[model samples]
Target: MAETTVAEVMAELATLEDPRTREVNEKHGDDHGVNLGKLRAVAKRLKTQQDLARKLWDTDQTAARLLAILICRPKAFDRDELDAMLRAARTPKVHDWLVNYVVKKTLHAEELRQVWSADPDPVVASASWALTTERVAKKPAGLDLAGLLDVIEAEMKAAPDRLQWAMNHCLAQIGIEHAEHRARAIGIGERLEVLKDYPTPPNCTSPFAPTWITEMVRRQQVE
Candidate 1:
């Protein structure tokens, strides 16, 4: 596909303003019926249009939540709110868990670190998602590597098989990002046997590479 630009995305978003598109989308409002792939595209596009994303997150909380669960919606929310949600979460399956995950992927390194430092959830396991937990699977750098290690270790002790898949997903993204730093990066060198040669989503951009970060995500697919 040719490169998708912010303006192109805006054109599509503008369509949402159209009564027909909105009617179609609204008609498909059943949580399962909503086009998650389209929403992921919305999230990916939002990565570039921060101002527009902020307005969406602030002005339409329900729409934002909808985008998050179906689209990685929280990436565009205010940083303060993102951090607060992470630190204050009582359970991994809280109402806004997906929002926090999207935000984790979208945050700057320092801001992401603050989230890791403050995050309290000990272990997270999601069969469907890679790791929607705050700072574990998404943040690029400046995280408490040691603390993350502890959490993963604890997770392994608690349930090795399940957490191992999440670990694999995490390592895959890391490998794709800092190809140069793979040597010094903790666990980057260590192979998570379960995750070894984990398949990259053929249809979606590889999650590890910033270069591959795009204005759309193929959510209809499963890697």
Candidate 2:
């Protein structure tokens, strides 16, 4: 198969854009509406997809950028390159896609987590906490669980919105996945009271750590 140029890949993405999805996503502040399945189809077709992925990410359109996250070579990125991508991501959804899809898969995740978690930039900090949250969810060995709890306890309330969300997520993961840390995670959640009152959609557990942990534990008991 012939290598597809970035321009050709972008045109393909434009062809896949869904007007209704775009409208719905735009209401939530994201600009593009390409279907995920369609994007994956496009990913499956391109040769040297990472080259196209880099250019697409630079476009910063949400749908194209999401495709970029899906296709980009994690190994191609140094910490600086990853940091730049995190810094360039303007919206929460984009930041999240990059963290979950790109950063989480990278070898530099721990290194990035340590550096970005302490950065003053909220986006960078959010990405760090996000990576850490995923790490906890997967029950990785030798994590500084105590140190993480300390940070959450100390700064969750005062952290920026996106960063606070990711920190709460980390706390929840620890509670849900790490039996030894569950009690302290709940304690931290109770003390911090992060997202305690956020309205939950019907049939969805609250994302607040204490409630989330309690509800999951209850479900496990019944099951």
Candidate 3:
């Protein structure tokens, strides 16, 4: 791929637009979906287009924002800027992308998580829990897992909707990754009835923490 300016990339994005994909994406919390494959191609070609990312993120176009999240260097923004970005995430899909691709990928992630987890804003707290889950899955060292489970057990039932999703995810990750916490996490899930009534697809395990944890363990065993 030849070097391409941000303008050229934006033009390419325009050409790749699919209204049908946009419609489906909006149903799933995005304003648009310029195919993921195309986004990958562009990201590969323009790795860490930080300047472009800032401009694209400001546009707030969902497709452009997805590309922005992909191309931005994690270190490009300081904590305040990242906090603002998290606050700007207006949709769940965008928030998830920012958590996974931007915030969790940063060197400053742990520091930010500590602050955000304690924040009063539900979106900020949700992002913190998302990062916490990743940390639990990959590197459990130094994390106060017991404290996390205590909070989840106490507050999950009354958490804001987004926070509840992430708190449940954290619970599941704890059960899957830390054997000591498995039974305790499952007990909490049973008590809270987390996602017990949420619809699950055929062949998919329930998203309730215990069942979700078991499904993860089963997959790990197969792998």
Candidate 4:
């Protein structure tokens, strides 16, 4: 059997584009129209093909890059390569998958997290906050939860949309996971009022920090 080529995968993704999907994705700053479920199925069939993943990523098409993240070995990338990839991933979904799927699994995550947290680029800083939120939930020791609250209080309100949202998630996670910082986190959310009026669908928990923190805490108590 022949190995799949980048051209072949690109053609396949071209065939999977949906107009409505593209419309919806574009509203959120993603350019791809390929359904994620279908894209994952393609990755499953392709399996772990690092060379092929590199080829696909170099194509710079959003769907191909998404597929690349799925197929590549996360640990194969060095710090510089991962940093380059994150900067190149300008769109929302690709940036997200790279952070969540690839960067998070790498040995370099913590180092990159510290570097990106102070980045001048809000998109990059957002990725750092995403990583920090993970630690807040799963590994809270040694992290300055109060310091995080202080930063969120000072900067989150005026932040760009992506950075603001990421900071808000960190705030909510700190409130949800840490008993010591819960009150301060909620209080910061109340004052900042970021995402306070964002519409949430029926039965969905609000992303607004105070509401999100309270609801998650309530669920924890019930559990």
* Number of clashes recorded per candidate: 1, 0, 0, 0
Top lDDT model:
4
Give every collision pair in model 2. Answer: none
lDDT of 2 by residue, 150-184 (tens): 88899899987778888898899888888898999
Ranking by TM-score: 4, 3, 2, 1
Which model is ahead, 3 or 4, in terms of TM-score?
A: 4
Q: Weakest 10 consecutive residues, lDDT, candidate 1? A: 211-220
Tens-place lDDT digits, model 1, residues 142-220: 5544444445444533444434545444444443444443333334324323333445776654433222221122221
lDDT of 3: 0.87
Worst 10 residues of 4 by lDDT: 137-146
Quote each prediction's TM-score.
0.35, 0.85, 0.88, 0.98
Which parts of model 4 have CA positions greater than 4 angstroms off? none
* Sequence-dependent TM-score of model 2: 0.85
| Candidate 4 residue lDDT tens string, 89-168 | 97999999999999999899999999999899999999999999989988778888888888999999999999999999
Candidate 4 achieves a global lDDT of 0.95
Q: List lDDT for all candidates, in order.
A: 0.42, 0.83, 0.87, 0.95
**In TM-score terms, which candidate is top?**
4
